[model samples]
Target chain A: MVSRRGFLQGGAIGVAGSAIGATSGSLVANALNNTAAETATAKRQLPFYGKHQMGIETPIQAVTNLVAFDLKPETDRSSMLRWMTLLTDDIARLSRGEPVLADPAPELAIGPAGFSAYVGLGKSMFIKLGMESDIPAGFIDLPAFKMDQLEEKFSGGDVVIHVAADDPIALSHATRSLVRDSIPFASVRWTQSGFAHTPGVVKSGVTHRNLMGQIDGTANPQLNSDDFASVVWMDQGPEWAVGGTQMVFRRIAMQLDTWDQLGTKSKEEVIGRKLASGAPLTGTLETDAPDFAARLPNGLSVIPDFAHIRRAAPEAFKERIFRRPFSYEAGISESGSVDVGLLWCSYQANIEEQFLPIQRRLEEFDLLNKWTVPVGSATFFIPKGPEPDSVIAQALFS
Target chain B: MKKIAVLLASVLLLAGCAPAGQVEISDAWVKSGEMSVEGGMTAVYGTITNNTDKEVTFVGGETAIAGLVEVHEMAMIDGEMKMQRIEGGLVIPAGESAVLEPGGNHLMLMQLTGDLMAGDMISVKFDFEGADSITLDSVMAKPAEGGDESYHETEMDMSN
Candidate 1:
């Protein structure tokens, strides 16, 4: 494993320092002298720092969802146990910010990411069983979950756990415990790194890259912005969890064969945002909301009703979830078939009340629904990770 | 005689050293690999060269881009990859190049200065050991894939 110290690069620090500096925009003028002449700066700073030590200053967090059902549930219990053990160990390492276990090793590995630390929670049977109906059809291993269906539905999950913390060591300890416990699981997904911010403040929008080359996630929600993070990140989390938020990871893959055929315009319309720039159809920028009621030259909604953006964010500030997701490229077959899609994720205090409504609405009508499929789906309720106390779900579920 | 010899040796070492304009930077911008032209706050990308023989310890740097710009390191703990700040700014070895690549090591530019045009470049000076300063450059490239051509071609260059 590459030691965290070894991966240290001065450039990263340089940028981080600058980010912290920029956030003090209001304070900057005050440092020297805030003149009554220069209109006193407005609303100091956005309270949404995420749930980590860095907050908006934190580099984009990459998440990968690896979901492989114990399809038969009867396929060699011993093998499943061993697989879970390996996965458990891997999760421990990942939570701590270590790389995936490999020979030569990928250039980038996983670590606790920051000093914020994290929590890894293993779901109890009750949550899993209850997931049967309310969960998306995809997680049930249905057609929508298949690489062909691309309906972006949930598939049943065999195991689920959430690992997150600002401090690498904290994440490590939690992950190690899971491994020692001999949990059964598989990593069917991974979150790539990137950030989406309000138009002028940060890199705005989800013009993220999919393995297939076309900018993916054009239609996904764009949270993590100051306004949203502050409003969306609930303060009910424990004190150590301050500056940190909650997270949900879903392993959803897209149908490369069919999606590659759609024109860029078709893809954009399906997502409700521009494919090239990620801007909302109705708004000038990606971070801006699409003027759903705004009419086009032909007198139609600028962003169509079935568009993902509209479905995902119906009421402006009424319902919002902080989203930091990644597009993955795994399970590619030689026969022109592939499993490449998003490691769908979001951060919120209440999943049932806050997140599900948007997801259900999307499932009902998103036009892009025809292009992406959710194969291996699992819901991991992550708490603001930090403090050596205990895992997040432990307190909530146990 | 020993004292004289020591003094002479010290003088030689100091004399041979050429002044490296306290690590200066010309162009600096912050963005992730997945940056866009139309995006208001464009992800910034840039390069920082030590330009000196002595190791340059990074204290911290700042910019007007976002509400704050932090030096973030992208690390892969186990399976989850996360970005964070190194307590003491990283150490830049003498006579070498340290790159801020996408998804790995980068400048988390927050509140931006202006609408980012694809070709536009921003400026930010770096503060290093002592009053040591380095003016570097942040070049806006095509939205990257976490790694660049130079990154893949010379994997062995990382003496680390």
Candidate 2:
């Protein structure tokens, strides 16, 4: 097997870094700014320094790249410390529209482009670093569901870096920069690219449409609200995970060619929502609560018993989770079918409590499962953001 | 990947024929490579060509592998995708072939009496709109092989 150290020792990092930077010239703003703006929607910068990571609760950007890395076999705690220190600085400098250490083509850094990077450690990292005790409760691998057709290439990793920006090129450049810097200690395992509606494409607060053309993410708790904090952040855990949350990422493959044959009425019955508007079967608006008790003129329930919304509905207030999903298209397959799917991501205080029950219900009997398959799945513990002088997860090393 | 390939193979079978001037059934095959741990659920694929000048409807069918065999269609409806029992029978237009394959239209064999292994033979029969009922014997074949294609092939090239 070719190790990451071997790949970097050949002295090709500079070439890779420069190529990434060279491709983003058109995406960066022509003029540069010296002062940073404070608004979340500001074009130039998103504050990287914070109590919690900026990427988690900050407004979702237009583009995202989720990349996973496996640590080299020789990597140790000391190597991890060095890696984190460099990564934290790189994140800070890039967020400020500055180049990372030894950036071959520094010009690309001039446009932060609303960039933000969130880092997390996968379960295997704890065992690899000999810090298994630090693995927080509810951080284990998710129990396999009935519909999972997980592919090895997309599943597990030792660490993950989620990079997002308003510009696709900017996102690509930053992701390349990070991978280049970690070349000696880690190797890329998988990378999933996705996009959302461009900023201002729709009303500011409207839920985004998934590839399936359904209004998704309609019930997420408002950012920075008390409910958000309660549902997403961990109040108590290992010292390093105090404010951190657990993230569940599942790559769900949607079979659109087969799905295209269904009628509008059948589709509505499956999702329990109106096609034109995302309203429940018995409601008039998108946010209207679905009345599972309501019936039709024929004396049958309006929403079918197997409708997706009914199966995924939480019984109590605390069962909710914060969902941020992105749609991805790989390419056309040999069979002339398009490979499209959702990068279904969720953040919650505890995976066992908030996410599993919902997934179990969907697995048991959701009508929507017929055309969708879960092909990739993983779980990670995302550490909270750091102060200006401190590095992320700095406490774990102690 | 093997499961996907087998499912694709089941979809690719296009041969089917029946005696006389009616529907020709050919290329009949069953897929059973990797049934889910839940087990018992498998699919069959074949092509039904209408030989008559008029359209023929496939009323229903029965199989020895399971107690109940249903003609089901899988499709995305209004942003939601589902597979439901075809309310009426499947219609094959005159002189056209109705191909039942994975990810589209196919046979759903439920409540199996035994696990279908390689080399097993499944017997099934279908009733058409105007012709005599026909029985088909499909041999269970090995699952199709899946090629090793890197999942990251479509991303921007990363090689230095």
Candidate 3:
């Protein structure tokens, strides 16, 4: 199959190269001289999470939903450095468009800053390097995962790698691979892809959802171009991360069956925007600029006193998120219904800065909050780049 | 039965022979251009001519820029002037020139690459079935904020 990416590339750059050779390589070379996507190398080692990987694990519903890993507590400073390298490598490899690269390092993955330990041993300082070893297992929360099968074709054939390593380093290595490959990925992080639910999001099979369903991210940016950049990518980070963006993968399952049971007006209120274009209640069309000061036909605030979009954008922080999501369906058995929901993904700078505040406010009312709930969740940091750097590659056991 | 069959065949033939058309974007670049940051989705208007001998229909074209591109027919909707993406492509008759001007059947270049002050050409390819496929360089003009295409008639002649 002539891949959509390949087809588009045929129109976007294919014509250029053929035309370039016909004329002179000077023009083509000069145009690509500065582009990150045009100049980056093909493949590189994922710095972190190498030794811990048991290979890409797929979920039952034909969805490679869980990108899980094996991890242990950090022993010393040397272990920390090794873990950091793996973390950075994951980010590097991913940005380049060839994530599932074999050969990730063990000593370099995430066990040093693993958050699971916090849930188990309480606040112990010395046991298992401050990690809570007793916490239950988790995995990524997308339904209908298919390992090695490129799912969907919304933006051509962009892959979403859902990963959860024990430590930040491993997660980082996994993330880097996503970034380097330019493969659009989201990490909820705590759960393994294709694995059973981590006891939280059980109602997934009946309705579409996420951790906080209310149909989260009704106000996402368009993927027409890098329009997502302004809303998602952050500036002023580690120079390596300067060009990168942050991706927030939340497993929010909407209680659609329940949402359908709500009053029509009440349901509309949960999502501040309209069901059609996602425009503010005061307007229409997804791209419509909201008139915050305007009143409805009945004299009420067009966006209402408590709406998600208004709080999310707020004329002030003007913070927005670019969402590239897909629907997942995990079939437990041939007869039983499948676990279906959204692979809720968003990109932005500081998750705490932009996404959390909006979510916190929505969690307050969001009318749809009744049915929606957050289950297995993890936050993986994604760097911006079309390629990995030399500093990030490392051996699996290094 | 024979008469009905003849009538049906005639209708089917008419539908199939509907005019085929194409659009070409020449010397394209974004107007009101500004490089780097803080640029709005500009308007892309150009002259689209139905070059076929038969009266061709200029259907809709899609852009990678906006979430969705519509064939907008600007008119007063509910008291406020509004433009909507026509369900189908713009019907430009064969041998006639349909200038996709601002305030009319113009392309609303939403979610543009940047402030097009320095001349940015949005790559848009329009396919006209059997006739031909022409790619246009849509010039970006931010007629207004959000996604409205009603503008004070200003014509920037972008002729090939």
Candidate 4:
């Protein structure tokens, strides 16, 4: 399949000077220069004003800064509205490559590079704002799981911002702009920066691999498909949250040292998929449906019962959640172990119905669990996108 | 001077047309004074578009939250970038814009009555040369990233 990113790249290369001598060294050099120029000058942008938030359904960017903020004691509904307005203006301007008002380094604001910012409200936000009754049903905080060793610093916040861009400079500027604007109303609780392969490095539409080397997000609902809309967008909720969804963000650390001890066969058995092609044990392609019932000559299932994929599979069609994950590396730990993990984010219309059941299964029994630890977890209710001339969650404020 | 002659000729030509239009300000915002104590300072920024056929001069402005206001500019003095008061005013050519931005020409508000928290709105009345005064509501906001350099280096003339 020609992925959207591939098509864009193809278009870009096609428009450049002709490659008359296709195999010539000079042609290759010229092509490389053109690609470099394209990466530098392409002002990619994602619209900030839309029916739903941009980052939710938008293709993943090269880098992300997931920041959570705790509201100050004095913050009230009125003050929250003001903060949202300020953030909205900042996001809108930064997404379009325009500097926010009083931007100190306006020059750094250039090149939006597909920049987008998503805002979500935690359970505490509604409580503190005296709007607990307005919290969308099924948007409660996740119950503690047996596999969790969640840290307080990374766990909870009143608000969270997911800022992403293809270019690190644009992402950094946008994140700083929003965080600085939030100073009066909130304080930074934690920040987790994650990255995927740089744009153009990976072929478009290829599923991203986690730090564990397993192809991730293989079973995700196709973007813009009806299945995705139903699974990821809220159609039944309070007026303020009709187009919003619930996000379950967990920082799962990988035990790469121990995982590396396993041979290819053991790793495949643990994940129920080929590490190289990401194909299920019973199939040849990543997109092929896993045949969980397929039996071996010894009468054992092709995909082991405790395999990660098997345990994570949805019991019912309604239980599926859309996953948009990124890998994070925080350098070596105190013990000299590599501190790397998956910043797993799953979006669903109802977290209770779609996400928890699958998570419960994984927590109970997944062979891959031995090599992964959940260290940080939080759930947030992302509100509907703002209308023109209004801030996000304007309905809730009203 | 040729510049003065052209200015006079344009004024005469505009006088023959319909009455001059109003000066408009947009994207108006003021820096939060939260970091500063009472009687401290902040700056206002926006684009002042002169829709009038004649040139418009922004002399100064006043806000209920500030004791004094002045037009200031960031200029390259010697080899260093320095902030100084614009002596006369900022001129916006007819149908052109004069941008009051950080690291550029701005309206400086000094002797703040109290801390201007983010999200607060202050009404500022702008005084113009040969035009009616315009009042606008500027939202208070913390400066965007990298916007603090000028504030740290500004050599304010407190006596003014």
Best by TM-score: 4
When candidate 1 is compared with the true two-chain complex, its DockQ is: 0.01
Q: Candidate 2 residues A177-282, lDDT tens each?
A: 7776566568899999987777667754426787777887776788879989999999898767888999999999999987878888888898998877889998
Task: Please estimate how well model 1 matches the true structure, expressed as its whole-model Cα lDDT.
Answer: 0.45
Per-residue alpha-carbon lDDT of model 4 for A317-336, expressed as tens digits?
Answer: 99999898989999997888
User: Tens-digit lDDT track for model 3 on A1-398?
Assistant: 89998899878887888877867776666667645422231121223322112111111111223332222332332342333333443333332222322222323432222111001011121123343341112111123221112222211111133543323344455544433322111112233232223212332221222322333344455433455555555566444345444445545444555666666566556566666445566666645676778886798886766655655563335455555443544444475434455555555655656666566566555544465444333343343332222222122112
What 10-residue stretch in candidate 1 chain A is worst by lDDT? A37-46
TM-score per prediction, in order, is: 0.42, 0.63, 0.37, 0.83
- lDDT ranking, high to low: 4, 2, 1, 3
Best by DockQ: 4
User: If both were scored by lDDT, which would come out higher, candidate 1 or candidate 4?
Assistant: 4
Say which docking band candidate 4 falls in: acceptable
Docking class for model 1 is incorrect
Candidate 3: where are CA atoms >4 Å away? A1-70, A74-219, A222-227, A263-266, A276-280, A330-340, A384-398, B1-160
DockQ of each two-chain model: 0.01, 0.01, 0.01, 0.29
Fraction of native Cα contacts reproduced by each candidate: 0.00, 0.00, 0.00, 0.54
Residue B50 error, candidate 1, Å: 39
Order the numbered candidates by TM-score, best leading: 4, 2, 1, 3
